[model samples]
Target: MIEPASITNVMRALADPTRRAVYERIASSDEITVVELTRGSGVTQGAISQHLKSLKQAGLVAERPEGRNVYYRAEPEGLTPLVDWMSHYGVFWRERFTNLRTLLKEIDP
Candidate 1:
């Protein structure tokens, strides 16, 4: 079963446009620094940091410290619960369609 809290956290984290943008940026890259994320991002470095903090809390991003800089990267495992929950629907529909097809074949055969 999918925990409500996990779904809520993922949804809440992605609800903000800026936060979603930051998460996507991290997801697309191997790792990105605060300075690297700031370029053309329009938001201040502090704001980016704040957004990263929220992302980390939501388990969408993982942070690592290297000397003076902190790097953020996407944590795909964090999204597993959400994906697993949604995958159930795909299986359900596939089985439902197969049953329907079988019934039709019986009727026409």
Candidate 2:
């Protein structure tokens, strides 16, 4: 249960390259550990943890603890609002383009 204002927070949290990479990796996999996420990113485990903290605060990720290990996974639905917002703008652009096409056809005819 995340609020709409938190969507902006989530987007801001994802603006960082490392955070985005971590998020995408989590999105692709079912669950990922902190060490796993830091493996090829050249970022320290501590840094990844910090990013994860921000992501969690933004409601973009969730974590589970299991016997001294933490696993992270993406909350894909957290991005729904942003996606829906873009969809609305997409519809607006589509209508504008359709109108332009009709106007061009009329001018040529």
Candidate 3:
């Protein structure tokens, strides 16, 4: 049972290099303005805005409107779908390892 939309959103939003860099910058800070997001990234403010828009659509980023400025930050909980998908495999592997251990004990004893 895979969440197609969830995975699609994350993958599509992260597929761009500039967007990925901006995401890292946003995640490293508590909150950042669009102006600050591209300070050292060599990208234009408008481009950053576009990237932020895409990220927001993916639920990977959150925005805070303050007067005339809008702040952005990473939304860690937004990654739940992806994490949950991976965790499904974690349980499978754990069970396999446990069975292997039991088999080894039976062979030795």
Candidate 4:
């Protein structure tokens, strides 16, 4: 039931450290523009735009064009696939930990 494609896209889009940083900034901000992202980032505006494109393709960010600037904001729902995948494995780990806890208690008792 996990969406491999969506997870892959999200992972790939975030694999780049710069891109991940860009995503983080967008996530923390109410909204931002490419120029704002590029400033003090040491990356060119074009590069920031490209990163935004990748984020958009992964459904990680949404954009709204206003006047001469396009503002971007993080899309929280974009992480659903990744969250679902992790939750699926989280159950497995939780069960293992519980078993280990019980075993340790029995040995101590």
Candidate 5:
């Protein structure tokens, strides 16, 4: 289970657009270096490094040093609880929308 504080930290980390982009890039790839992420996103290497640090702190990402390069990858299970929470709300909204649609149909008909 994800701790409440960790969840808050992850949400905070994801609230930044740069960090979200960085996270998405890492998620789609096996692993990436700060230089590669910077080159791909047109952000500075220092900026990418900072975002990576935040992501790592949030448990949304993990890093490994291989030789001289530090590579980052998404922690797949890190977002599971968040995703599940959103799914629960998604179902609630879906049912509400369906009821709304039926009400509108009744009113129009």
Candidate 6:
């Protein structure tokens, strides 16, 4: 079963466009630092850090400290709650689509 709180947290964390973009960058890279994420992002380093903090809180990203730079990477398992919540509604949508297809076939023939 998916926990509502976790789903909410993941959704809330990704709801912001800027934050979502930040997450995407992290997900695409094997590991990246705040300076790398800030480059060409049009946001300040502090803003990126803030976004990273939210992602970390949501379990969306994990960080490793090496030397003076901290590398951030995507946590694929963190999306389980959100994925489960969406999958729960998959049956409903599939049934609806099947009904629509039947109706379309009847109308066409």
Give the number of the best model, judged by lDDT. Answer: 6
Q: Which residue pairs clash within candidate 1?
A: none
Q: TM-score for each prediction?
A: 0.80, 0.88, 0.78, 0.90, 0.78, 0.88
Error of 5 at 92 (Å): 1.7
TM-score, candidate 2, is 0.88
Q: lDDT of each model, Cα atoms only?
A: 0.91, 0.87, 0.91, 0.96, 0.88, 0.97
Least accurate stretch of 10 residues (summed lDDT) in model 4? Answer: 79-88
Per-residue lDDT of 1-109 in model 2, one digit per residue for the tens?
Answer: 3356866887798899888888899899999999999999899989999999988888889999999889999998778767776788899999999999999999997
Candidate 2 Cα errors over 4 Å, as ranges: 1-4
lDDT at position 84, candidate 2: 74
Global CA lDDT computed for model 4: 0.96
Colliding pairs, model 3: none
Lowest-sum lDDT 10-residue window in model 1: 77-86
Error of 3 at 71 (Å): 0.4
Tens-place lDDT digits, model 1, residues 8-81:
88878888999999999999999999999999999999999999988888788999999999999999988886
| Residue ranges of candidate 1 with Cα displaced over 4 Å | 92-109
| Candidate 6 ranges beyond 4 A from true positions | 99-109
Candidate 4 Cα outliers beyond 4 Å, as residue runs: 104-109
Runs with alpha carbons beyond 4 Å of true place in candidate 5? 1-3, 101-109
Candidate No. with top TM-score: 4
| Candidate 6 lDDT, 18-101, residue by residue in tens | 999999999999999999999999999999999999999999999999999999999999899988988989977999999999
lDDT: worst 10-residue window of model 6? 83-92
Q: Score residue 14 of candidate 4 by CA lDDT.
A: 89
Ranking by TM-score: 4, 6, 2, 1, 5, 3
